[model samples]
Target: MFGVLGPNGAGKSTVLRILMGLWHAQAGSVTFQGARLPPPYDALRAQAGVVFQRATLDDLLTARENLLASGRLYGVRGPRLNERVTELLKVAGLVDRADERVVTWSGGMKRRLELMRALLHRPKLLLMDEPTSGLDEAAFRTFWVQVSRLRMQEGLSVLVSTHRPDEAQKCDRLTVLDEGKQLVTNTTAVLSRYVGGDVVTLEVESPDVTAAVLRASLKVDARVVDNTVRIEHPEGHALIPRVFEALDRGTVKGVTLRPPSLADVFFHLTGRALSSRVSNEPEPMTIRTEGQP
Candidate 1:
């Protein structure tokens, strides 16, 4: 599995749409299996499956009807189509609910139905954009479990786009991006090493001043991101007391020490956190500890 990982508005969806022939790129050529694909990309479309960021099901139709209509669009019909639909419904664990109107189903169930529809034609490549956007932790785990089973069964090559770091970690390889620009591409293990050792994040009233103070006093590179002063050091446990002694009393609001994560890697490369929440929105200046979740 390959992942396109980044924060919001990072062009993940645009890249997927371009590959799916839904949008046209102005300058660059698109290729699949080393062959250049021109407009209307028939070859790529015929061999690829897509699950868009948003839901796109006909609520008025029954789940079975929806799958049947989608199958016919790909020129799949007759007994083969029926057999395929039955197989997919069983795989999705929606066999009992297949005859019900889609509008009555829960969001996760609808997402499962969409996944089955995407695989109706048994395309070789599966492209998913934020497939688990609103799923709870349990539902998210369940969804990916189905994907893994399907991958092994169909020998599929999946390309998924996600802003969530935990979701990206599930990929075999990742391409991290910032504002549509590729920062780096590598395995998760290699990328985590970019910020060696422990990550010390300090929630402070003034991020810029605290960062400058740490750099000037300790001679360590520090970055200010989203009201937090972050430092990468080999000895985080020993650095906390020095940080308090260097800064004025009550200057620091909170302190968190954790091992390196993909979020830390993004911050190391760009001096910015992975979150792209609106600037006007008030976010609590609390970073996740080692095992808060």
Candidate 2:
């Protein structure tokens, strides 16, 4: 699956909406398959399924009923519709709750039902916009497990838009977007490689003193936060002994070394923390209208 990852107001939802023909881009065209997409592109719409951040199922309908309705909307009926509904229930692990009303289901269950409903038509492309929001760790794991299985089994082409780094890393490839502009597209490993090598985190009794001493002694850019000092270096392991020796008389506690992650890649690109930004501002609203797919 491909990913569109960036902070809020980065136009991820706008891009998806434009692709779905729900919103028009003034200066660009959306091409599907091998031809330019037609206005009110019914063919393209029929060949795609989109899942928004919120659940789209009717609360009064049972999970099974919801799937059947979606199938019927896509012109599926009779034995074929029933078989597809049953298969989707099994795939989403919601077979036990198939007859239960959607209002009685948990948040994760609702998300799964929405996914199953999206798959009823068996479209060529699946677009998910922040599909894992508000889910707990366990629920997130289950969702990814199902998504991975679908990709491996059906070879579905998926394009997911998310601001979470962990979620972005799960995709086969990532397309980083910022304020309606494309930044980079690469694998997680390749992006992490840009951050150089291992990161060294030193917990010192006095961060200011340790940072000063390290700067004077070593040729590295050390940033101190509270009681810790973080440094990024090509030879982090080799510098550890020297750091300890420099802080021999000082009150140093411990040291930690870790490989680069998506967080680091983001920081390198944006000069800020993702969690910090997310906490300071409200997430952008993700709206999906009916009659599109």
Candidate 3:
């Protein structure tokens, strides 16, 4: 799996739409299966399954009806289509609910049905845009479990765009985008190492003041983000006690020490939190392309 990681207005949806040929790109070429694609991207669209950021299922349609509609678009029909739909519904654990309208289902169930619909034609590639946008922990885990199972069973090459760190971490490689610009592209492990150390965060009464105090007194590069005083250092284990000693009584409400994560890498590269929103419109085809296994 490969990931395009960024927050809102970072062009995740726009990029996916362009790649799927649902939206036109001002420039750039796309090569699929060793052949360069022409305008309209009919070939790419035909071979890849897509799940947009927004739900596209006709809520009034039955779960089975939705999958049947998608299968028809992909030219799967007769016994083959029936067998495929039945198999996918079973995989999604919605065989009993297949005849029910999608509007009556939970968000997670609808998302699962969407996935089943995407895979009904057995496409070579899967493109998902924020597949777990509003799902709870249980729902998110269940959804990804189905994805992992299907990928392994089908040997599919997947491309996903999401701001969720947990989702991005599942990818074999990632491209971090900020304001539509590719800030970095690498494997998640290599990208996480760019932070160079552990992250020590202090939930304090006054984040700015605490950050400034740590910078001046401890001589550490402390930054305030999301109302927390965060200090990134090579030896966080040794720095923790010193940090506590430096702070005044009752100033800190909580402290957390952990290894560097994707969020830390984003902060190191962009000087801002991954959750921070950017308003810039994406330049067409600004993506730095890479191979997907």
Candidate 4:
């Protein structure tokens, strides 16, 4: 599975639409199974399924109804269609609510149903855009569990787009995009190796003072944001005693330190914090026109 990791307006969704043939790209061609995609793109689309960021199921329709409709659209029917729906229900853990209306389903359940709908055709490639956006911790765990199982059972080639660093870490590989351009694509391990250190966050009343002392004493990189002084050190823990000694003489408040995370990797590459940079505004999933560039 491939992943697109970027901020809200970084054009991840735009790329997905182009791949799906719902929109076209001006500068590049999309190939499927090693062939340049043709017009109409029906052949290419048949091999793919998409789950949008927002719920697409009919509110009045039951879970089973939604799946059956999707299967019908894919020309699946009779015992085979029923069997497939049943299997997907079990996979998504929605069997108990198979007859429940979508309007009554919880956010997680609706998301699962959408996933099941996308899988109804058993497409070779599955594209998901922010599939776990509004889910709680428990729901997120359940979603990933099902995803891992599906990947193994169906050998599905999955591509997911998300802004969450933790979610990006779970993917097999990641494509980090910024401002409509691909920055880097690699495994989590490879990216982490570049970090080569732990992250030290100091919650001090006077961040400027703490940053000054750390800069003078340690051969490290540091920055201040949100009243917190963040430092990157190869041996971050080893520097704690020295840091404490220095902060003790200043107007310090608190300190926190930890190993490098995906967030740190993002900051190191982008020169900005991921959480702080992404907009809180709800972004709509829309198609990008092709050949406009």
Candidate 5:
């Protein structure tokens, strides 16, 4: 799996459009599977499966009818097409609801059916834009699990574009984009090495004061985020105890040190936070009962 990651207005959608033959570029050449896609972009379009950020299925059509119609674009018909539709519906767990109108389905169900539609012709590659845009946590997990398993089973190549860092991390490799330009393309492990060290987070009573002390007295460049003082250095774990000892009695509340994440790598390279541009789904937080506070 490959990932294209960037913030809004970063030409991510344009890239997907170009790859899908939706629009032709005035300049630059596009090649797919050793075939040049210039004007008559048939070869490229013939074998590429595309899933857009939005649901494009006909709401009035039944799930089976939608797949059958989509497949016909590639000249898929007869018993072979019917068999393929049946098999794909089973894969998407929509076999029981195959005859139901898509307008009656949930967002997750439509997305799953869209995926099945994409795979109808068994294209050489799959291109997805913000594949998990509207999925809840459980639905997102289920969708990804299905895709990953399908990739292994079919030896399919998937290229996904997403603003979510955690989602991008799932790819085998990624290309980071900013301002419609490519920043870097490499394996997750190699890109993460750019950080060169670990990250330390200190939950303190006074974030600004603690951050000021770290910069002036400890000579560490610490940044304050929310109520935490975040420090990134070559050896964060070793400096944790020193930080705790230097702080006032009640100032230091908690400390954690860990290796840098993909977010750190992006920030270190781009000088901008990915979370600031994109949003992350927070895990479900439990509500406090009486006396918990």
Candidate 6:
């Protein structure tokens, strides 16, 4: 599994559209298996499966019917198609809901159905856009279990795009992007190469005061965001006691120290705040099945 990971408006979906032959890059071209991808994707369409960020199913159609429709679109038919659909439905844990219309299903169920529908033709490459969006931890893990099984058994190449940092951690490999530019690509184990040491985040009564005091006395670099004092230190545990000792009593309320996150890596690279929820409009991070924009 590969992930194109980034915050909102980072152009992860744009890259995916280019890869799926739905959009053209302004400058560079895309190559797969040493062959340049041309526009229209006449030959590639049949070999690639896609699960959009939104649910593409007809709510009025039964789950099984939806799969049949999608299968026929890919030229799958007869006993082979029926057998494939049945096999996928069972694998995706939707056999019980196969005959039921999707309108009554939960978000998790809809997502599972979409995944199954995407594989109706058994495309070699699967492209998922925010496949886990809106799912709780349990549902998210459940969905990935099916994906993992497919990878292990079928040797499928899955490319997924995600805004959630935790979801990106599940990728076999991922690329971090910012403002449409690629930052780095590496395995998750070594992705932290960009982040130096541990980060200690403190929620104090006065962030400015705490930051100023730390800089003036301990000479540590502290930055304030949303009334929180955040510091990254090589020896974060050692700096904790020193920070508390240097500050006046009751000046500090809480402090947490841990390894850096992908957000921290983004901040380190571009100095941009990654946690800001600027867009209420959901961009392919997950499926908003109600069709709200």
Judged by lDDT, which candidate is best? Answer: 3
- By TM-score, the candidates rank as 3, 6, 4, 1, 5, 2
* Model 6 stretches with alpha carbons more than 4 Å out: 277-293
What TM-score, computed on C-alpha atoms, does each candidate reach? 0.88, 0.83, 0.92, 0.89, 0.88, 0.89
lDDT of each: 0.88, 0.81, 0.89, 0.82, 0.84, 0.83
Judged by whole-model lDDT over C-alpha atoms, candidate 6 comes out at 0.83
Candidate 3 local lDDT, 74-142, one digit each (tens)? 999999999999999999999999999889789889889888888989999999999888877788899
Candidate 6: tens digits of C-alpha lDDT, residues 222-292: 88865689887898999999998998888877789999877677677777666564232344354466768
lDDT tens string, model 1, 192-268?
Answer: 88897999989899999999999999987888876689899998999999999999999998899999988788878
Using lDDT as the yardstick, the better of models 5 and 6 is 5
List the candidates ranked by lDDT, beginning with the highest. 3, 1, 5, 6, 4, 2
Of the candidates numbered 5 and 6, which has the greater TM-score value? 6
**Candidate 1: which pairs clash?**
none
Better of 2 and 6 by TM-score: 6
Per-residue error for 21 in candidate 3, Å, reads 1.0
| Better TM-score candidate (3, 6) | 3
Give per-residue CA lDDT, model 2, range 1-293, as digits (tens).
88888878888998888777788777777678888876666777788888888888999999999999999998999999999999999999889989988997888888888887888889888899989888877788888898888877766899999888888989878888777888788987788787879888897777887788899888677766434787778888998988888777656667888887676676567655544433323565656789764
Candidate number achieving the greatest TM-score relative to the actual structure: 3
Query: How well does candidate 2 match the true structure in TM-score terms?
Result: 0.83
Clashes of 5: 0
| Residue 155's lDDT in candidate 6 | 70
The local distance difference test score of model 1 is 0.88
- True lDDT of residue 77, candidate 1: 100
